[model samples]
Target: MKLASLKTVSNAHNDSIWAVTWAPATEARGALLVTGSLDESVKLWRGDELEQDGVHTGHSLGVIAVAAHPSGNIAASTSLDSFVRIFDVNSNATLAVLETAPSEAWLMQFDLKGSTLAVAGGGSASVKLWNTSAWRLDASLSVLKSDASVKGSEKTAGKFVLAVAWSVDGKLLACSTMDGTVGVFDVSRGKLLHLLEGHNMPVRSLVFSPVDPRVLFTASDDKHVRMYDAKNNSLICAMSGHGSWVLSVDASPEGSALATGSSDRTVRLWDLSMRASVQTVTDHTDQVWGVAFRPPGGEGVRAGRLATISDDKSINLYDYS
Candidate 1:
């Protein structure tokens, strides 16, 4: 219903923290808070006290996105330089390093089954999928195709892919581009199903509802969050409040609520049933870049938790119930 501030860590990173996600708990430990930053480091924290568990540094540029495999043993991170590193969560051992050149990698996500890693290709106008078993390049799902004669730089600038999301069932994959087009694809057949259009500005973040696979939510530079029925290709509704770009969005595990981070330097809690923002938390001094909900299942981990990272070089934890 609402988020109550539990703890705040200042200077959590040397520079701006750009991304955050919770690694599911294993028999050895509870879920760990994973954060990537402009400092070119990825750090892991444990418990509500936010103790530092580990720090990984290899990225040549600022880390842009981080994702945890469903099994919780493996994690991956992408940097601005377009390189992806997949590593072991507990041992911090490097598992694989993927070089995405020609096409840039902006955001990445592991499917529900952890069989594939999907990276939003910034300039390729496609989503690149890697097979987890072999850690090999699997396929590239093109969201937009232009004339072959179009110059590479011009084509990339026009339709850069910024974000990607997997449906609850892992049957569908949705990717958003710089031109405000959201493409829904059928993973099995590797075909684009439809494009959801409404916002004219870049759509930076998106997610599929946990309860309904067909329902999708997107945050855009247009300063509004729009809900759509991806399967039907229909816009359901749009909610507005953030004064600047909506940077990130995540749905509650129960699918009844949503959480978002914005350039307005605030984290907002949205009541999905009401389709409006119910609470705003202005705890960061600069832009709020990432917000994530702790995944369910752990040793006696029942209470809900939300973690947010900001350009202020801080991390905030909230008690969600």
Candidate 2:
């Protein structure tokens, strides 16, 4: 597979764009792309044209993570202030405002069914799960306990959960921590199954394969991306080419390709069959923070699309073929 540049929007955000996700198609609209930034706002953009749909702001600090519900009608964003905002995608109306303890809401994602939301609880060393319908705390999957003195300090080398992902079946939950440990949990039983440890630095991003519930991928400050078998508790392979930290990763809908962004100021497309980067896009002048593939399902949506955001305050759109 190859990526052909479709559009580039300079200064797409006033500050570093930290998160990007695709909202599925609704009855009234086609699929939309949403991004969160250090500018403390979440901006929505129309598909391949890269046209701005709207911007919503209320967070006190930089928005670190944003996730669109599977239904596409709702979305959630979390900030450095440990606040999670659930809002309407089309109307831009605030639906819920959830405040986690300082440093708890580092990353978040909605389950495949949109019935539950899981957050990587930063200093808390747990995955915070929320019930979407009632907007209430549902479950907390604790990975490790922090040292008493370093409970909430960002500078501490504790088990700070930095990323979270759920399997397509919604049966497994994985959370990666600042210390580079990935914890796998059984969602149905609320139990910690085991910890996958290969990375020593922070594992900042993770995603489950869209095609396989047992295959998991992770990106870390170690400047490498690792693939693992979540069910068997083993590492499958590790790919390294980025000059700097591998910051984010997202699998394609077809499951044959993976896209990643890094602190090296480049976006890479990995071929799953070869287990190597097939294309590297150096369009951003600064670190690339987020990359997302447009979810399958809208009207007249046959072509594949990938979107990326960077610290250079820009957004890049590409056609995956």
Candidate 3:
């Protein structure tokens, strides 16, 4: 896929736009993009222009997580206060406020079926699963360990989960934590399954391949994105070029390419097979916090689409081909 700048909404947010997700296009609204910022606001954009469609508020601290319910009718965002706000993507009305105290919050995600919500439980060293219908936390898959040095540590767990992803089948959930641990869990059984190892730094972003359940990609402060054999927890390839921390990552609908935003103030597009960056978007003047490849749908929207948000308080929409 190639890259083309579609639009740049300057001062899109007052502070860092730390998280983003694409709300699948609906018959009534078309596909929309949602983003959460450190300024404590969630903003929505309309059409291909990426104009401000609306804004949702109530977050008390930096909004570090945002996820669209698989159905695209509802979306959720989480902040440092450890609150998850589920709201109507169209009317912008609050649906439910989910809270898990005693545990910090980080990246969030909804199952492919839209029946469940999964959250990376930051300080709790676990991934919290919630029943979407009741909006109640159903099970907390704790990162139990027998690896002696970690199991009994009192350092408050640098294994603080920072990001998570669900396999395309919705059967597997992988969580990346501050301690550089990638825990692949079996959600149906609420059990810890396997741990993927490679990076020694905090893993900030994770995404399961849309086409391959056996494959997963992760970005970290180590300035590398490694493709992994999820089932076996084996490293497949390492893609590195970012000069600073890679903050967010997502794949296109076709699964042939992926996008990453980094603290180096650039958004990069990578060819999965080549394990190399094909394009570097240097438009953002500050650290790029998030990047997403819009899902393929609707009647005739061709060309790949990539959306990026930055600490510079801007949102950039790029045409990918």
Candidate 4:
């Protein structure tokens, strides 16, 4: 499979675009592209033509992460100021604002059921779960630091949680830390299951395979993407090629492929079975910060789509086939 450039939106934001996700289609509209930027605004783009649908402004600092609810009508965004704003995707109306003060919010994801939203707690070393129906704090799953006396304790100490992902079944939650440790949690029990260790630098992005809940993929500042069996806490394989930090990663809906964005200013398509990058796209003039595969659903939307945002202040849409 390859990605064909469908449309490129230059200056999509006043500053660097840091995050992107596809809001699944509702009966009223097809899937919409949601992007958050350092410009302190979150914008929505509709259709393959990439027309602007709405621009949301409330963040005080750079918008760092954006997540779409499974229901498609609601979405959430978080900023460097440590606030999560949940709003209506179509109307841009505010639904709730979650203030994550003591622990900063980094990346976030709504569970597949749309019943809970998990926010990566930056310095607290935990993942905070918010109940969707009441928009209340449900639970905080804490990741314990490895023994300080261990060989590489200095590098792992006082690290911040940077990224998070949910398993296909929503039964598991995985989060990555600035020190490169990936912690897997049992969602129902609020327990840390295991830590998948391999990368020595910060891990910025990770995703669980859509087809297998136990399989996970991660991208790191170590300039490598690693696959692991989360259930067994075993490293499956590690693929490397990016010249700089690998900033983001997403698994295709079919689970046969993976896509990554890197500080190397490229987007790479990986063939999962071969455990190697099959194609590298150098479309951005600066660092690529976010890459997302469009979620399946919506009328007449069978063709796959991939959206990528970058430090170049551009958004690129690709036909993934």
TM-score against native, each model: 0.97, 0.96, 0.96, 0.96
Q: Over the stretch 1-321, how does candidate 1's per-residue lDDT look in tens digits?
A: 999999999999999999899899988889999999999999999999999999988998899999999999999999987799999999999999999884488888999999999999988889999999999998999886556897877766658899999999999999999899899999999999988999899998999999999999999999999999998999999999999999999999999999999999989999998999999999999999899999898988899999999999999999999
lDDT: worst 10-residue window of model 3? 148-157
Whole-model lDDT, model 3: 0.87
lDDT of each: 0.93, 0.92, 0.87, 0.94
Once fitted onto the true fold, the runs of candidate 4 whose alpha carbons sit more than 4 angstroms away are 145-156
Residue 191 CA displacement from its true place in model 2, Å: 0.5
List the candidates ranked by lDDT, beginning with the highest: 4, 1, 2, 3
Backbone clash pairs for candidate 4 read none
Candidate 4 residues 79-158, lDDT tens each?
Answer: 99889999999889999999997557999999999999999999887899999999999898888755666655454365
Clashes of each: 0, 0, 2, 0
TM-score of 3: 0.96
- Candidate 1: list runs displaced more than 4 Å: 145-157
Off by over 4 Å in 2: 145-157
The candidate maximizing lDDT is 4
- For residue 2, model 2's alpha carbon misses the true position, in angstroms, by 0.5
State the lDDT at 178 in candidate 2. 85
Winner by TM-score? 1
Per-model root-mean-square deviation over C-alphas: 1.6, 2.5, 1.6, 2.2
